[model samples]
Target chain A: MNPTAIRLSPLDNVAVCCRPIEAGERILVEERELVIDVAVPIGHKVAFVDLKKGDKVRKYGMPIGSVTVDAPAGSWVHLHNMKSDYLPAHMRDAAGDQA
Target chain B: MMSGWLRSDGRKGIRNAIVVVYLVECAHHVARRIVDAAADPRVQLIGFPGCYPNDYALGMMKALTTHPNVGGVVLLSLGCESFNREALAANAQQNDRPVETVVIQEAGGTRKAIEAGIAAVARVRNLVDEQAVRVPLNISELVIGTICGGSDGTSGITGNPAVGRAFDTLIDAGAICIFEETGEMIGCEGHMAERAATPQIAEALVASVHKAERYYRAMGYGSFSPGNAEGGLTSQEEKSAGAYAKSGSRPIDGVILPAERAPGPGLYLLDVVPPGDPKFGFPNIVDNAEIGELIACGAHINLFVTGRGSVVGSAISPVVKICANPETFRRMEGDMDIDAGRILEGRATLDEVGKEIVALIEAVAQGQATRSEELGHQEFVLTYKSSAPSGPSCMPNAA
Candidate 1:
């Protein structure tokens, strides 16, 4: 079976979705099964473990950012839930409007 | 074995290009008209738009004019600009490259300047072609640079790591490899420091990343763009982790500032952010500015990794585009050279793609035109910036 998500590092709390995964679909990351809580697009991250607010999200065995809200295992992890520790990430609308 | 154009400076270039340079923005049109009139793929145009003199700009121009890939230079001056055309011309001439200067005001303005510039380019091109030397080139003799633009999550797992693997193979073969954008390498400092060749070099690496952080923090931007977020990257460090994968897992020999050539064949980090307080805007306004800095550092070719997709190619050195997103590759197949997204699709392994990238590099060095090159994408950019010379610890191994 083709993998829907890949865990880049053993220490990572997130796995990157290799293909578009719909909500409620059950996916296996290594030996553990995860029920997709939300639709995750290709190249986006999915939480492999339960994350609490202010907990650092690890990918590539490094802390990418911290969770802003509580996200259970298999939920989509992105800008809405996490933010850069150094600088805020800009979206298309914020381009050129940075102070 | 591949053959290269041998330069008087003992460097071998995969290409022999005649460059037309405009000293100021006013002379840009005339210089462009000259390049357009030449109608030769080997002829390229590069310039600085500032009317005021900048030491960094002058140094960059000097390095580019005498670059191994460049065979001759035709400088366009608006006559009264503070660019110091005489010094630039003399520098190129000293390197045994044919050099010519067309002063717009002295030549009586637009139409006349274009006419004079066209003549100068033709003369320079002819001299360069006649004096060109063909020599045997080994993979060891080549200098390669890597940069990722329009990057996303797939970049780290696919294209970037594939390039990293290619870099490892190249470095082992004695080729010089450079990975840049210290701004994009924010969170990877601790990991990078551990891979430094010496304790001093590791400290320099950490200091360089800290400087980039301070500089970006002061500027209120972290080189994180909107498209990056749209492509599934959540933060700057996330993007940085992906970007850092292009360096490959090798002991970094040293750090070199922009326009400084690597001391020897090993992995080196190109610190592009300007030193001191952020005075002149962004360190690199666009991707091409970084490409220009890479070329100035003696890179014969650059491997550009992208997930959201970038179609830019440089003026002097050829840029090979590696697409990390299979979806982007399907949509912009014509713009891409390597489909590294195959790793994501599970259609190919990273090692397979890594070998393919090395093979493609050899083919490109042997005169194969990259997709961007065939499309005539000779984008060039240079802006005002200040950088202090790197300290001794930055290159402890350098003689």
Candidate 2:
């Protein structure tokens, strides 16, 4: 058996799915038992709790990006939801023009 | 922890490598034949492709020949290539290492050059092995390089930051650390400059990044890359932050480690983008180009952090692979040395990974082969370009 999954930072609200998670799999997270739905590829992220729209996804206690859409516990948290906190290209150019 | 092989100039090398560099694209085949004939892992192939006279390429080549990691060098020339082969050979010889040149035309042909190169590599390898003097090395004497590849979402949060933590530890210990790829460094210039040792250096640092931005902008690709977007990075700045974490919060010491010139100590930024304009071409076409740049600046080892799973190192130095994605580590454990990804799954902390990297560095310094080293991933590449000399304030005004 592949022992327990490894959690990154204390602030990380997600555990990297070390092993591929198949649908309906019951994975242990701290004390919670979150069942998986779709197959999460290895090295991808899985939520530790039910996250809502606009909820900031905290990994390493820093805001990596915000969860774009709602995500249920054990659901996958990836590009479909997470977005960067840094400014986009247009804003960056605007900021550049100010100087 | 243990004794390391001593080089003549008071520097130490973990492994004594005889580098066989192709002076031009035409000579690459002959050089490879030579390395293959020698069949020794310690003998590696490196080269530039363009037949143009590029100051950047020439300077970098000279720097790499005298890198602390190299014990000897052999230059292969097609004789007519614009590269300055005689100067390269002279530089290697000046380093007190045995150096020789094999001009394909002068040496008769490919078959002759191959035989000659093989003999040269074998001879150089034997001499280098005997030149090993046991010397005491400290963490402070270590020159380390950091690079990130195959990055994904977890890279910034786990792997990259873990490297940053390790960089912090190494820098605090007085080790010389380097991080590069300004194209990858696009958006975070201001923040990165803020971390420099001095405000003056910060401004120069910002200018250096702007140089890269201009170069890449001319090339029509954000240094961010398509793979980065596939991995959840939206813009260049976001990717830069994750990549920047490998510095571990150390005060930036200087910018663009001059080819062949070692920094006094502390963290450095290898300004890889052309110093002036993007005249040559792709700013470091592949990851190995960056690795080559670090070697030119005297890196004895590289702390390579990967989240999307990269199975790579370098020829002259051992690459300590830190896997940031727990899942990626699980998928590619054999290729990684440290699993900073454990932080994401709540199995390990950043401190643990940092310590592991240090121990790995000491072990590698004592001749323990890294995963990439054992796999024999000795890749090298150099191309053409030019750069105006960095203005003062690029680094702290030298005391």
Candidate 3:
């Protein structure tokens, strides 16, 4: 019930992992009970539901990135399973803002 | 608990400055020497590093030299560059502020120029200190700018959003908030346009971003910096969304540039892409260029959101770093102003950090020099660039 951990928007498929969710720390999100599947680091995201590798990573009610690999419900969503949906052809470059 | 320094234009100033400026790269050393000799926090060094004629640069220089926050100005000129020294002086003169100039070639050399500059700064500092007095001010009259540099994946989710919260708060209080770097706005036109308060203004907002995308596309380069990828950013649009978050949720009022001021309060976007051609080399080759635009827009202070980390500040405006990444923040805490990552760490709430920013804004406007200011980070840079006025579709509110 702490205010620090918040769901930015209802449509977002993930919640910012504000605090380190322990192996058994139960949390309530949008009336849905999500049991911790793995340790989600702070500033990272936790899966709102079961997701496949190609499913989109939703935040702010929009697809911010997409799952690079498969992720499970209550799993930590990050680089391994998500990549930017905008510029996909190239790696990070200073002037490569047009993805 | 908030107070400000009143300027002649009726706007309040957050700083009372005696800016010693170099008209060209050739005179930069002299300007630096003078500022060093003066050795006062209020006496700051800032200058253009370019020698060629640049309209944007000139307009920006003039705007900054006479910013409400500045009380006096001293020009260090090499005397041969087409920097329009007289015009800059004349503009400062119109404000009835103390302005003196020393031409290194005519002042015998850099040594004499520095000496003259030092004395001028000393005199101006005395005058500025005497002239400055706290005036009751409100949030509505404030002009704030938001910029991003050294960004990573977290920038958008944390630092940028945190600034967004603060911006929303400031705008609610009637402050004029500005966010810039059109080049970064690529792939974000739809979102930005949707946020425009009016349909007409929304179209204009879309057009400005479109223009920027076209300009960069012509250059055969994308706005996504490679450093961005290493920092966890994967796409240009993702980078843009993060960059866009700095605008807050306020409806787009209009678009302005480095040398312009917002006509009124609300959120204004600054189009930083050069109007046309790659002739200007790089629209804004570095972060300073964006800061330059914000200063020219009459921004008294800046909210710089960073994910990787940035240390550069400005000559006319004080930049407050909003650290978005915890690792980045840990490595560069000294350079940072706020740690937005605290939200991620469960140590603070978005609104809590937002309030902290609001409180810091008050403190800075009340004459607290930012960390950048304390470190003597008075960086100024300008280059040649051309911009066709935005099509009528842009800035529909600016009749």
Candidate 4:
């Protein structure tokens, strides 16, 4: 089977999509079957385990940010659910709106 | 064996370039006109736009004018700006480089200054041709720098790690490898500290990253940008982990600030963020600004890894572009030097690409032009900033 995603570390709670993953597609991660709930673009992250708000989102064996909202396994994890612990991520529209 | 121009300071350079430098923004047009009129690919334009005198800018100018790659310099001044042209010219002359100065006020006007600058460039070029001595260069004598820009998720797994492997190969060959942008290294401090060769250097490494965090906080922005977010990086630390992979697995020899050369041949971290309170607006406005700092530190060539595909190249030193995303590589193949994305596509391994990068570096060192140079990309930028001198503990291995 072709690899669909890459998990950087064994301790990571999320895996990076190697190619665009379609919604409602069933994929096996570490032999566990997961039904992706939403389309995740390539390079985006997908939760490997269920997460609660305030939980640390782990990647590369470290906490990248805190989950802002509860997300289930196989769900897309991004700015909407996770935010940086250091500084807020800026988007092009948000920057232009401030300007 | 590769041959290079040997400078009086016992440094070897792969390229013998004559630079036209404008001391202030007012003299920029005339300096650019001079370079354009000369029509020589070896002649390039660089300048400081600040009308106010800045110690950092002055020191960078002095370092760049006497850099190993530079054989001659032409200083352009507007006569009213605060930049000290005389001191810069004297520094270049002291290094045995052909130097000339043209003050716009003294030379009458813009047209006249351009005329004088063109003639000065010609004279400097002639002097450089006569003075430059060809000498055999060894791979161990080279200084290489690495930086990541326009990064995304694929960078860490592909191009960044490949560059890291290449850095390891270069360091083993006794070449000096420098990795920079402490602001982008936020989440990897612990890993870096553990890799430090000395206890003092470990402390210095952690301190530099913390300083960059505080500096970015005060400026209301981390190095994290809109493009980074759009490219699928959710946070600064996430991006940093990918950026950190470019340093390879070597024990870090030291930590040095911008314009400070590494004391010996090993991996060194460059702290691009200035010290003290956030007086300057940003640590680095663009990728080119960081490239300037690397050049000032005597980097002969820089490896630039990009997942979102940045095409920028520096003025003084050559930038080897590494594309991390296979899709991006297919789109912008002409601008990239290596397709590290093949690792992700299962067409090649990281070790294979790493060896390819090392081979490319050897070819470039032997006087081959990079894609950027062939396309006439000589982008340069410098801005105001302040930094106190580093302590001896920063380089414990240095005598």
Candidate 5:
């Protein structure tokens, strides 16, 4: 992650990828270096730490959504593993297509 | 500083526009013909198609008719619509803007009404051109609004923040700025409330987002669209993170419902969703409805940020399109005013693009046509929605 991923706020546990990150790329978060487990496109979020099911995903230091399944650090965090706590995000309907 | 046309209400406008409104869908063709036949760039068309009277639509039409930018308004009625055309015409007249109405049934037929409307438009155009005072305009007099349509992930990173930067600059210099779409700003209410200038305003801001959330939830859908996901947005909250960037880092001044003018200068948030139960089908059916609300709130010019790209301009005010995606901007060269995608490519920095946008606004205020305007993209739409009238607390300064 060196600086390719934008850390919006220090309190956030996730960072938005400023540039696309390939699988196995190194990502730096909170002084810890982690390898991205999968390719994440620009603007998509990447986990800064190991996320448990029901953990709140933070970006810009605010809770964007909640994780639905446990995910390791640096994994692409999107519709597959996360769901909005406010309303059902439309991407859930076409989850299979996202892959 | 640029010159603006002075209105009777002491507010100056960047353009002296003559708006032609059709009371119902039946008179749409005649209204369009009148505007087209006038063959003048200053004459623009806007209307409500639903014959069933909606208080929201009437208020919006009244606001537009007397909007600072509008020099006059022509109401095209088909004689048998539920719309109250008299109230709109009276509002225009009360505001001292030339007002006229042509009822198709009363004018004998479509052809005669068109002739009457054309004549009316010409008379108003001449009267406005002759009477409008050219006054020195400064940044303080500006009321700028920003909105995003066809947003992708890149929008939050590029165009949105660029507009944010520009909004910050304008607010720093004492100009009024507004950002809207509460439905899109969900999940950030806590953070946004922190920026409110007053504690009461902060509470109001949070309530507004909650209102949008409740309304959309009842509709069985979030504001997230299929196009949004296709363009790299995964969820409503994710899109909101980007959409909220357009507000920059200014203190929230106050809130205003649709068709209510901003009380004074500084940064204001427009709550587009209705207050009570979801009476209206949707808050806003499309982007243009939101734009219409912005215009009704007296925005002199709108900065429309688009990642997927939208080619739309308002009737009363010029819309400056800022393209967020460099790839999309490349594909549609002439439709956008600012290429914010340059931020992504590193060809331009955020500050550079922001300054460019501010400069373009000044240039446009001095009477330069935006790309959408030059290309004839006058897309206007007004849908039904109701909100309780704003209280004195909503406009802190005016109160």
Candidate 6:
């Protein structure tokens, strides 16, 4: 069977879950097999190596953002622990304009 | 090759629809009612909602009215709006596109204006129909644009790459291909610059992305969204990288502003982000506005990639929706023309899907209605934005 997670590039620190991965499920990353410690939903990111706070998170071979807290290998990397490192993201205001 | 309608300027059109444009917000209802009353698929509705005049809006309206797909035009004005209705009608007439104007205030009221509009549409439609001439059109004469909406993690991996492959094929066939949303491409400027055809174009590409970065930053925003993160995209640059894949691997031929036509035929990048600061609120308030800009630049059709599925079609041009998520395709099969998400399931390869899309484009151009077109999704929108004319460096090989 193909791996449940897909790694986009050799430089990427995280892999995208092609299918929902359960806690303790085994997956392969660059010929190295690792066990997940958390349930990573489909299309979410799973860190392949432990990363500290403010470390750049690489995906598709480039830095997508930075983590806000120290995250261990096999853990979920998402909005809860990472944020955009470029310009501040524009959220919908009370008027609900995309601006 | 397909038989098509030949326009006065030696350009071939895939469709011969009559466009009805409302010059201002006040006249929108009357124009829409007129289109509804005509009940003809050859008639479409498009308009601008501003009461104030903007050069970009005026130029875009002119470009759309005379687009190869349009056989004629019917302009609706509210009588006191700042938009110059007479100039628009004159331009359409100058291009030999039969045009008629109806002013609501001058025509008495809304009811009377609608009555006049319906009658005028019938006359215009008959004129264009009588003028139609069947001519042979090849893929080289086609200008195709692409945009990704409701993007998710699956979009970059499946839909975008499939589109990239299609773009490469189309470019090899000598067709003009364009991809926009510079704001979404902020983080990938360095990567895109290397693929530019000329050193000047490479500089322009980098500068344009930097301009977008500055503009979005001033608005205290990046183009990233909560849904994007939910769908496995973590940062603005990540989404940019995914969006950048639609350009394929071809060297970018030129950089054109929103309303400017392509300089000859090759792959081009459209700078949709307005120059200067965030004066017009957002660069593109939504995806449809970007589609509007694409149509203005003379695209006969648009290939829209959506993981979350957008059901929008343009007023003057048809939109072919490609679904990126396999599960989403299963749920919304009726809305999409191509199911690119199958690549993820091992059901198809990327090249297979790319060929399917190219064949579908020829079929669609030869009068096969897209699912969105059949569903009557004529969503048209244009807002205020500023732009300086493209420099000589932006367009290579000028007279």
Worst 10 residues of 4 chain B by lDDT: B390-399
In terms of TM-score, which candidate is stronger, 2 or 4? 4
Residue lDDT tens for model 4, A1-99: 447887889999898887788999988888877789898877788899998999999998988999999999998999999999997788888888877
Give residue B186's lDDT in candidate 6 (0 to 100): 82
Error of 1 at B229 (Å): 0.8
All DockQ scores: 0.78, 0.14, 0.24, 0.73, 0.39, 0.60
Worst 10 residues of 6 chain B by lDDT: B390-399
Candidate 5 lDDT tens digits, B93-159: 9999988899999999999999999999989888887887999999889999999998987898899
lDDT of each: 0.93, 0.77, 0.78, 0.91, 0.87, 0.88
The CA lDDT at B166 in model 5 is 97
By DockQ, the candidates rank as 1, 4, 6, 5, 3, 2
Order of candidate numbers by TM-score, starting with the best: 1, 4, 6, 5, 3, 2
| Candidates in order: C-alpha RMSD to true structure | 1.2, 5.6, 4.1, 1.3, 3.0, 1.9
Residue-by-residue lDDT tens digits, candidate 6, B228-289: 76677777887898899999999998888887899788999999888877888888888899
Q: Quick one: best DockQ, which candidate?
A: 1
**Model 5: which residue pairs collide?**
A1-A26, A1-A27
- TM-score, candidate number 5: 0.92
Off by over 4 Å in 6: A90-99
Candidate 2 segments exceeding 4 Å error: A1-99, B258-262
**Candidate 5 or 3, higher lDDT:** 5
Model 4, residue A79: distance off in Å is 0.4
For A24-83, candidate 5 gives per-residue lDDT tens digits of 999775577878988887666788889999999887677778899998888888778888
- What would the DockQ be for model 1? 0.78
Model 2 agreement with the true structure over B1-399: per-residue lDDT tens digits: 666667667887777788999988899999988888787798888888888788878888888877777888888999999999888888878778878888999999999988888877777777777776778888888889989987776687778877788788888888889998876776678778788888887887888788777776776555554456555454555577678788778788888644734447888888887765566678777888888888778888988888778897888888888888776788899999998878777678778877888888889988899998888898777776665666566656654
Candidate 5 CAPRI grade: acceptable
